[model samples]
Target: MTTVESKTTSAEATKLTVPSRPGFRIGRLSLVRRPFKVLVNLVLLAALLMLVCINIGRGDFPLSIGHVIDVLLGGGTRIERFIVMDLRLPRSPTGVLVGMALGMSGAVTQSISRNSLASPDILGITAGASAAAVALIVLGGGSAFAGVLATLGLPLAALIGGIATAAIIYALAWKRGVQGFRLILVGIAVNAMLTASIGWLLISADINDVSRAQLWLNGSLNGADWGSVWPVMSAVLIVGGLTVVSSFTLGALRLGDDNARSLGVRLQLRQAALLLAAVALAAIATAAAGPVGFVALAAPQIALRLVRTPGPPIIASAILGGLLVVGSDLIARTILPVELPVGIVTSALGGPFLLYLLVRSNRKASA
Candidate 1:
């Protein structure tokens, strides 16, 4: 064969031997597209929408799904609009944004730690936020000045507390570098300390303040309003976008530290940045919804199993997180004789799941 013909044949052989990833490229931008992942996300999104409608229609008035959709699209009467828009709309969206944040946060943490059990809640991020918020509530109770501070300062306090706690955990975990096992161990210890602090604050506070703090601690969507939804939405959009962009490195990180280093991954810097993103997401979600439990721990793992990814896919995890929160909230509202906190329902679900994971892990180890 001529030189050009041989070269062409070699190129074709290379192409045949190297399997392209299942995705599309558009000039400068490319995405790894998994059809199953897309379908799962779409299904989750649809389920989330349906739940939102059902949630909006719930209550004494009881509007139908069709009516809810009509009112949502600016077709209903003023009263219907008032009920859907003014009264009930905020809670569902708030739940969704919170769920998405937790979901992504969980995915990042779990991926970084390479532990199925690693999550913001387990790592004390949620506990730190809760501690700060509860302290604000209890310390600032009874006075007009305190009430104002509690109203305005709670979210900020929670965010700061979570970030600080994460920093401490990371610092403690860092010997030569942050190992996944060390990080998780440090997180659990910190979580215990923070939980103890929260308990102490509650005990020392006034009765009424304790009652209020307890309500908040239960993680209810009882008073979620437009005001609360905006911050979480903003966090989910901005920080979440950053997390998703950074996720390209997660697969590398998951392949063990030595392997990741061999692949030119800056182990310390990348891990810290990703962990910071996870902390921010978890903090914001906790601030909005009072540390809604188990969604963070469960969502990413559920998504991981469903999509059959080596690690949790961020988008799918976020969607599943939203679905879990919305569905749990629906059950909280309707399934019982009285309204229960969303966190309670989630804990009930997550506790069993955690045990199952532990059992499964043990079995695998033994085998």
Candidate 2:
């Protein structure tokens, strides 16, 4: 039989037969088939690239985009090199990496839960990271040891917290077996409790420490350097690799557990792998950028709506999240008279959409 597949569409379309070979298989054929989605993803990348250059050139000591490109390509004046290579280059990529990580995490999370609202931020994973990082910053001897704490201690703390929270939510949601709705409910409760704990920590800290903790809580890439960029890049590569490897299993999972099992998908193993990857990505991204809200919650859903695919489209989601974050950070830094944290801009953008999702979800449940 000839292979036929639905290129991403809101309405069903005739399956088109695409020529495929051994090296470039059906999965690769999907890339060829979904040309429109691919073009949209490319546009998002171009926008992100433009924003990166724009962000690099925007500051008190402004440089040109041409100069930024020259420095990036390894030929510029000493000051230009320092500005583009040493300073600004790291910042935009940091945002992109964090966004990609959150986007991937969100895609896996929503796909695994089979719920559109199921994101790391909404489910307490980011809150758990925030709480742990806050405790370490406010109470772990303050900025005197900030170099050591930020580089060594806090990321580790956040990862542990996220994993612990994920475990707890899974346990609480487990009745006979885990259900998506129960998992989401448990996550919401867990998120609320963690948020309250973050508030308490904020109130109890010294004023200086409060300032330091606030930066993390608000999630800024201001003055971010190579140190921050590498870990997030490493995470996006590793966890992203795992997600790509497990895509078939993930697609099987959307078929429901029994159907998945009949098709030889190791339900528990696949679920655990997907969750571990998602939790790890979200934890590291939070550790890098603080609890940058709404990117995780919105990116995959936006991608899903755009792609109209059966499962969360990870590539589109990552691109959309990166675009959203990079654009938001640009506005935060350059547009306003006072620089706002990138988180504030994202929250402003995401809040109304999130409310709409919640109301729609509630109405659906009631109906």
Candidate 3:
């Protein structure tokens, strides 16, 4: 038998051949291993591009899409360049940036909380920022520094408020390792109290102040120049970078405290870092876009569903959030002869989806 085996040819050797183990792939496609998800992202990107193109040419004095493209390529009339560069491009980027911040923050918060319902608004972050901005606007009327004060103080105040709220909630919920339900309950309570505070501030303010507050609350991108764009862009860049860096820790955290700890992940420190970054992002976005609610709530969940993965899906959420804001703003501007508030359009569009989520979730739980 040994002699016969030794005499075997290369072709006959296959008769007793061991199965070859599959080799590891080394490429981007191999890395993700999820082509449909990539296709979905591509579709979203395409839709967003189309929407931007359509909105660029829409106004009382509408420019052609071709002219808009020409302007983007660095050749167009003075008005065309001004409108594209000065007006539409800035607004578009602002919407996109704010949406990105909101979406990423929302994803982080919901993951950290381990509660699908946890959102920037639900955690009192947006409410805090809005309250601070409204107070500044109401109390500092008629001064040259009024806008400056509101703009500058808004993010800072929001930052403080968000940190305080998170601290309080975390402290309160720290019985046996910050359970998701407990955190969400505390967050909801804090959000309600802060929202009521905002209402009272509005109720006591003068009509003009209230009107200004209302517009801010409605989250307009009407005058989003580069100056206005930078703060938000900076916040998105800094906080976003921080989040991406900590994303692996976040994935670990999703496995629960004990498992994460066993894996050599420092639980409290990583959680604090992620939470702080998330809060900062939410605060900055809120300061920029008022309480642009529901986008934050809806975008991440939608993205997770689309991506068919777990743990925040931050990049996809950001993209979708930006698209949602820009598309909603476009609808707000064009659907009515008079422009609607961007916030109002987002709420209107997002509210229905939110209701669907709630009902579906409820049904699932009950079932």
Best by lDDT: 1
- When 2 and 3 are scored with lDDT, the better candidate is 2
Computed on alpha carbons, the lDDT of every model, listed in order, comes to 0.90, 0.84, 0.80
The regions of model 3 sitting more than 4 angstroms off are 1-35, 141-152
Candidate 3's displacement at residue 344, Å, is 1.0
**Local distance difference test, candidate 1:** 0.90
Q: What are the TM-scores, per candidate, against the unseen true structure?
A: 0.92, 0.87, 0.85
Across 249-351, the per-residue lDDT of candidate 3 in tens digits comes to 7778888889889989988888888888888888788777677878889999999998887766887888899898988998899986778879988888878
TM-score ranking from best candidate downward: 1, 2, 3
The C-alpha stretches of model 2 lying farther than 4 A from their native spots are: 1-33, 141-152, 362-367
Q: Which stretches of candidate 1 lie over 4 Å from their true place?
A: 1-16, 20-23, 141-152
lDDT of 2 by residue, 113-159 (tens): 88888999999999987887888888775555334446657678788
lDDT of 2: 0.84
Per-candidate clashes come to 0, 0, 0
Can you rank all candidates by lDDT, best first? 1, 2, 3
Worst ten in a row by lDDT for model 3: 23-32
Sliding window of 10 residues with minimal summed lDDT for model 1: 141-150
State, as a TM-score between 0 and 1, how close model 1 is to the true structure. Answer: 0.92
